[model samples]
Target: MGTPFSFDDGTAICLYVINRAPLVEINDEALALHHLSGMGLDPWNPRRMTALRERIHPFGVTLCNNGALSLLTQETQLGWHVPRFISAELAVAQWAREQMGGTEESRNLAEEVEMYLRAWRPHADLIRHPRQRGISGHEHQFDFLQNDELIDVITPHHNATGGLMRKLVDVLNAGDESAPKVRVIVDDRTDPARAGIEMQIIASLAKAMPLSKLLDRVHSGSA
Candidate 1:
């Protein structure tokens, strides 16, 4: 409805990830430390989750929360089965921590959760495909989340690929030197309609930069 957020760089890419666990099923400690203070971890609520998605969209990334990947894969809710393996491990690690008393073993369990979180990092990398970028969640950290650094919002339950693409086109045509390189990451799996919109957006960009010479100087001389 409003202008889509833009980045200074000219790159536009999308990252798609499938969360292995239901939001409620994730580890309590990680959830406690990271979640919205009073909101609880209710990822299924479209209203709450949609607001969260919008806040993080401005960072040159749009995350489709939950199992939207199933749309691309065409398997209904069956899509999350694969990644759930890691999420299950996360649950187990948390369960293990609870079992440990306040001893050296308990300290080790804490370390284990940290390591598990690190392991989950690859999932983002995997989805981003050929590009290198950071993984962000629906809920952001205290700094970005609280400082109002989040740029825009989109509904996670619905396909937001078109919204992402339109923003890119707007940024390119606007010729804003301050615009960041745009990247729209979608799950390898998404509904055909959503994916079709994403393709259309990409086509529009290709049309914009019809020739190498055209793209070479879009903002080359700006300071």
Candidate 2:
């Protein structure tokens, strides 16, 4: 609960406790889409994001500039706000769970990477669900931090593009010297074909690798 930031996509919340009050936020809502259907929900769609803002309004959560929900409490209320925070998490999680149809796929992929790291990268220090602000002032929430590189696990089969812009902007903001290298580890267990478009596009901005081939790439020192 005191962790800096932990993204539980299944619950659609990231807990970042700064000072004493806990700030809970939703990361990359676009991760909700699962298909390329013209009728599919963008999740980051103006309507949905707006609706989320309105929904959280009654709970007194702050609406972030990036169109996400965050619960900010006064320091004096912390001692009595535990229940309120749980309520907020449940409310947001229910709505987000519906959008992404649960995070089973990504959870499976995470487990795989975790096992591999436990076996081969035992000595490697790993930071999961890292949230960092880019030079452009935009924030990026990545899945893992390993080998000094920022890594993300994406199932980008349904996005047209916007869900990726945050990372793209983060990269452009890197400037020449401290440029961050992003690795998109995809959950290709479903259909490798579906990940092609987004993967190719993302590769132009970041490194794209499939979960199946992850061990090989890392073992070969190319990841």
* TM-score winner: 2
What would the per-residue lDDT of candidate 2 be over residues 111-150, giving only the tens digit for each residue? 6776765455667788876655656444455667877877
Instruction: List ranges where model 1 is wrong by over 4 Å.
Output: 1-159, 177-179, 190-197, 206-223
After superposing candidate 2, which stretches have Cα over 4 Å from the reference?
Answer: 1-45, 54-89, 96-101, 118-123, 136-138, 159-162, 171-176, 215-223
Highest lDDT among the candidates is held by which one? 2
**Local distance difference test, each candidate:** 0.29, 0.55
Judged by lDDT against the true structure, how good is candidate 1? 0.29
* Model 2, C-alpha of 211: deviation from truth (Å): 1.5
Q: What is the C-alpha RMSD of each candidate to the true structure, in Å?
A: 20.1, 8.4
What does candidate 1's lDDT look like per residue over 113-195, in tens digits? 33332243323222111221112223221100111111121112222333333334443454434533332222223344554
**TM values, all candidates:** 0.21, 0.58
